[model samples]
Target: MTVRSAWLLPGGTDSPGQTREDTRLAPVGTMLPDGELGTRPGVIPGGDPFAATGAGAMSLQVATGRAQVQGTAAQGAYPVCLDAPEVVTFADGDAQFDRIDTVCLHVYDALFDTAGQNLAAVEVIVGSATDTPTAPTLDPACLPLWDVRVPAGASAGVGGIDWTSALTDRRRYTAAVGGIVPRGALSDVGAYDGQYADVEGLLYRWSTADDEWQLYRAPELPVETITDGADTATGWTLNSFDARRHGRVVQILGYWVRSGETLTTNPNIADTLIATLPTGWRPVVLVEAIASNGYGFGAVAIGTDGKLTVRSWAGGEKANALEKDTNVRVAATFVQ
Candidate 1:
């Protein structure tokens, strides 16, 4: 194929001499300009495209499909399409040893070949028979779609291939240029550092250092209404009580009024149980925070048993007392 220049120039006049290479180079040029060459080759997402199914005997059938491949810049990109379902047959299994084979889409370009024939076809690349069989190596122009395991002495009858479990779907998908990849299409978590994927409505970023997908944003945790219990039993009316967790941190927000009798001289008044957090919401260890108690500031502690206890009051004439009919506020944050 002759390399053409000045093909996609702006304000260029149309010519009847345009060939298939001209049309193919247009999209490839568009994708290349935006650093999209780094985008992995894959099938377009939906319609169960290119699904492989067992077809009797030693044959396997592939559904109609479409895929994108980033071949060398000299060869340009390939938008491969299968107009109709194609059946691929494999050689029968070895009589005494199991083998593995790979189904792949192979791209043939005249630019890189001695024969000036350009074509794209689906081919089954057979593997070597071995006690521990492995899939075959693919050419740079080939994209794998599935792996088939042929058991020892397997054939068309009672010991034929078990279509149910012998086939492994190796299909993966690529996103539109600059779009977030779907989590299901991520075959290598560490392939692209900082790549983002949408996982169940949440965004996750690939972390190559950790070899994992880390949450890209702060997670939205459900705010739970704190049920009034021990504090209410002592004539304390809760105004607003809520709790929420973000990762390992749990935060509490609450307000209440001591409307009933308040102990003025009781030394044990600091051990007042206000409420209990739910099992999973409790802190890992005792955590304390300062809160407003009547006319003074008081210490509040949350224990591992989920108990919220009032420690003691300061900044008031009454050392450890809670005046009646006074308002109190509680706001604490701790690691669970």
Candidate 2:
């Protein structure tokens, strides 16, 4: 019973954005119950689905088919999970078939916001590795914006930019020459949902006829900009879009806040109305990590069970009341 697609439902059928009768056959090794789900559970790879080699563990999750990863601090022998390029064998025979191919890998993380009801921001790490991660290839799906003459020996992360820095220097970052730049002290505004969520923005996706990764602005965010600020960006270590933007820093900003809080356009977690939430309800928020200094996406929270939630709009916008008990943490990353 090999699967063609895989999904990660954080909550059961009762969860928001998920229908009561939501049961789809995923690729082989699709419905694996926790434990371990990496290509080599022990050997860490350089690319995505990399060897879960991090000593410090964080609870990570992504919606089925979605590329976003959510996490919380975990105290133990950390067992990291990589953005697996594809799934091979289930290892366990009880799962029926052996190998399965995955079109997308969506994970979910709830530990970051225990309060569930009031999570201000979160850090979402997305991988740009290709469908085959074993022997990695450079897939510039959402290249980060960076300058040329990049630091000697400096390599690129997902989408083709280098972000391996304690403090990203914004000096190297240059915008499209003229436009309204974003606010904040070193914010990394992304377009088409990058590997990391550090600024308030949207990541609409598109593909060229040739299958090249062509990104569109999130429907909610209609306006964007990237003035001549690469030098300021380089100072922040802003580099990743080179593969796509070719040194032009494109910024995603101005998302339409519906009902003063929730988003106006994003896929529901579930296909049916049963799992659908009201028009004005946003499960998570894209915020900056003020506590951690620098600019990283902040997160919002929805409790495990028996709770209520709502998103707090920027400029101190109030949110609508969410029904309790059926707390469904609905982010716009659901791919089904």
TM-score for each candidate, following the candidate numbering: 0.54, 0.13
Residues 1-336 of candidate 1: C-alpha lDDT, one tens digit per residue? 111111212222344332223222123222212143444676766688899888887778888777776566556556776656777767677888998888887666656865344556577787888999998887666678899998888777645788888898777666665466564433454355666777767877777688788878765775554444323435667777777767678778778777777756464554677666667877898899667865777787888987777777765446667777777888888888
Which of the numbered candidates is closest to the native, going by highest lDDT? 1
Report the lDDT of model 1 for residue 253.
79
For all candidates in order, the CA lDDT equals 0.67, 0.21
**231-308: candidate 2 lDDT, tens digit per residue:** 111112222111112122222211111122222213221111112122222123332211111111222322222111
For model 1, the superposed segments whose C-alpha errors exceed 4 Å read 1-38, 157-159, 183-194, 198-203, 207-213, 219-336
Off by over 4 Å in 2: 1-107, 114-336
